[model samples]
Target: MSNYPKTALVINCGSSSVKFAVLDPTDGHVFLNGIGEALGLEDARISWKHSGGEKTETPLGAGAGHDKALAFLVNNILADDKALLDSIVACGHRIVQGGDIYSQPTLIDDEVEENIKKVIPFAPLHNPAHLLGIDAARENFPNIPHVAVFDTAFHQTMPPKAYRYAIPEEFYTDLHLRKYGAHGTSHMFIAQEAAKMLGKPLEETCLITCHMGNGASVSAVKNGKCVDTSMGLTPLDGLIMGTRCGSIDPSVVFFLCERLHKTPQEVEKIFNKESGMMAVSGVSSDFRPIVAGIQEGNERCTLALQMYAYRLAKFIASYYVPLGHVDAIVFSGGVGENGPTTRKYVCSELEEAFGIKIDNDANYKARVYMGVDHQVISKPDSSVKLFVIATNEELMIARSAMQFVK
Candidate 1:
């Protein structure tokens, strides 16, 4: 790898997919990106695309997990690609959980990697996946300095009163049961990006960033640090998501296990995999069809949409305090950036309280494109400015990686 400040590779790992991007940190230009998925099953398809329109597609087997995928990236994606290999300076990893430490973008050392591994229990779904990616990178490109940009990193500033649970006092100091929010990388990216779009300094802006994807969360960022967020100890503690039940009552667990004769695992399965929009609508987990059903007068679909929008609006309203006054409500991620209908409903619900008005015409006109982008869907004179900006977590990770090399 070249010792340079301009180039860094960013890796993002999911339960079944690993996405990568190569970027020039000097002026924030992305050169290449790719994804490998359909893991743990046969005929896994790995695809790589360069900024120059060159495409490479390979077919691997079910066991070609994240490590193997990275091997593919290094061997093929970087082999014939002279520019990528020549300029590659450092690597960055997108880690999903940081537990209590909420470490900022840090140079990934043995201790730091082990620290991430320790939180696997808290983030069973994501931390293990993150470790796999980290290990893969370590094995494939041992020379490249790596940095971990935590999904929880940006939220470490949350006050004890806001993040702590009311259970036992020891839970805070001992077990780390307090809220260690996730998707903070996305929140951090969009919030700072919004500051630029608004022509305001990051330290002067207060933002509530709503990251709506298969996983979802809303963070109240005050003066560039997260003070309150919808996500709690785990990603399960927020607004409703694809199949995950977000923020259910603690009593519901007892109701399922004690009263319904379901085991803890069985009850957990219900909440983590069998609930939310899928259970409520009885339709696909995707919001596209669910949103489509709204026009056709489908009751279940309508209720699902209502639940999603209402919860989002509720959280957005609650974040007003931590933000002091609330300068803007920034939306990003899959559903947040693309779902204008949902954005409309969410903003309209708070129109009276926040004096925010989304221009329906502008929202519907927004397109789906990558990189950083913004749209002010609010009335020209709205007090609480509403913005929908595309997120770039991987690029943020890349910049962190460059710092690691430095």
Candidate 2:
């Protein structure tokens, strides 16, 4: 076994998959990472890799689920390396919605699990899966502390003016119908890294961070806290996403349900599952295929790409209201870090409107392939700096979990 620093086991559990990693919180050194996929299916399987090692896969028996998959993770994978298992100081679980109650990572106890259960309606698909993973991990690693790192935690700092909708006061007070932004973990990580790149303290930096992926959100951070963000009540309220309809008029839902004779659930499925780039481009939700279609002269695909960049740029520009003196505009996530074409379109829009210059050569070269974790994409003389900072949510989770290690 290699010499390893104290690490945290980070778990991001979904309905059918559990992504896990063991990483040192100090320098973000990953010791191992893997996933338990296709849980509860006939082909339920687990795949993993030790640091600097080849991937190995194993198939669990038919109908295996979270409990069984985590059992295999503990008994088969982690057990193989005694030192690695011993180095685990804590377990961190990523939770999607913590409501207004949890503003920071909390030590997981019976009370915390109960609190997660209370917010089930806000994140029906994610919180239960997280609880399952938490239960399984706690069962396996009984000696170590378990912490909950919420995706909504960082955005909880948003003031009432930012989070509250213009609805009736009773609705917000009684039902909690307020914005609870997602991707807080990614936003927080990028903000910290961007501050480091800017050679300033995080508390002194003002940034508009855009995290664009299959699911996308932009946040405005001023003086080290979230002042405002693009996403709202749910992730579907944000900028256009792979399959989600971003911000649409409320009447559209009524029009579809009342006039077109569709149920609320059906309309929800249409907006959440059958919209965005897929509906716009008549191509796959994946940007790669849409780009290919654009190359082949598909107008729909061209419109899709244009809409994606335009909507994203508009969100970033809007955040300028909250962040008066912007230190930088950060682009991170799958599409943000890798898609130079999208970045060009977005930065161009900002340039025309706000004079945020984008260096064509620098923007083209700043990407995952270039092996730079963070790089400025804007010209030196630009009014506001632009950056392509790769986000690391797992490491952030590990760091949060580390806080409870003692």
Candidate 3:
């Protein structure tokens, strides 16, 4: 066995926080993982843990941001172990938007950085934070290769018919206003894992991957490539999310502005931050609380769960047009991996329409928290198989980074 270092450092920076992990690209084993949150606030802090070790935390002091967090990662976290630091062969950055230019993971360079910057308007809050992290990581670890893994890259395979909006030609031609799905990394990871669990070659497998989380999307992966996805030009166009309303009438915007006398920005906020499960359930956006409310006989919570499942099932059935025959339906992401009740509700809706005979016992048991990474939750006689596969975007990013390291 080669003892040479084969680890990749994965960085996911947000507007005010940084999430990082050092893991082996080969086995998906995390060596260290941490988060630095509340940057530029009064109580900025970072917490981390070595593999199989107790977690440790430290305050980064006020006004600290990406640079200070990354500096702490190098100076205090990895400094004591030279071997660990040396083992890092690549740095993988999670970029939320790549616009139309990149279809795959690209090695980070000055030009690549500029391209990312150009897409800032598409991912205003996320891309800038990613750039900050990239710059900081480059300064902190100048020796290793850095790679950008875009969240929209996988969905770039969609045909024009699937991605195009029915607006004026000049809108798309001038401003590039078309569908660009989110959760590409998760969908890609789930498709690959679903193929493995089904014991089929990736190129021969067809899947409808439902990444159900606070922010959710459904994707049609036909023969190892994304043929269509639920999300559009922005995540706001997709399935009803935790806070964002999905796929509403276009005229509602004008209604809110003209009749309600609301500004564009306020209407935007209403769509993005004041709707979906939170607004429908009158409960927390987190699924747990909503589920609890259902148990307590809260009618709105029940309605919310019904709406969520219905929307998900509708998307799954609609994907049948893109993928003629699905080999499996994969459930992934935070809610998909753990929300058994949600899975049950959705599967019940799909059973009659799609001939999916889900095994209730198996579905409830297939949870990542229970150490079940892969589970076949369908009966053998079912026409379509069902699976719950845990997603690992960090591992996917690490593997992508490793591909360019040599």
Error of 3 at 244 (Å): 1.2
Candidate 1, 35: how far from true, in Å?
A: 1.9
TM-score of 2: 0.98
Q: lDDT by residue for model 2 over 1-406, one digit each (tens)?
A: 6677899999999999999999989999888999999998999999999888999998988989899988988899988998899999999999999999999999999999999999999898899999999999999999999999999999988989999999999999999999999999999999999999999999999999999999999999998899998889888998999999999999999999888999999998999999999999999889889888988999999999999889988888888888888999999999999888888878887787788999989888988757899888899889999999999999999999999977
TM-score per candidate: 0.94, 0.98, 0.98
Separate clash counts for every candidate: 0, 0, 0
- Tens digit of per-residue lDDT, candidate 1, span 147-263: 888888788888888988899888777787888888888899899988987889999999889999988999988888889988888888889999988998889999888888999
List, residue by residue over 1-406, the lDDT tens digit for candidate 3: 1243579999999999999999999999998999999988889999999888999999999989999999999999989766788899899999999999999999999999999999898888899999999999999999999999999999999999999999999999999899999999999999998889888899999899999888999999999999999999888887888999988998999999999899988998998899999999999888999999999999999999999999999999999999998899999989999998899989899888778888989877888889879888898988889898889999999999999877
Candidate 3, residue 189: the lDDT equals 96
The CA lDDT at 372 in model 3 is 74
Give lDDT: candidate 1, residue 269: 84
* CA displacement after TM-score superposition, residue 313 of candidate 3 (Å): 0.6
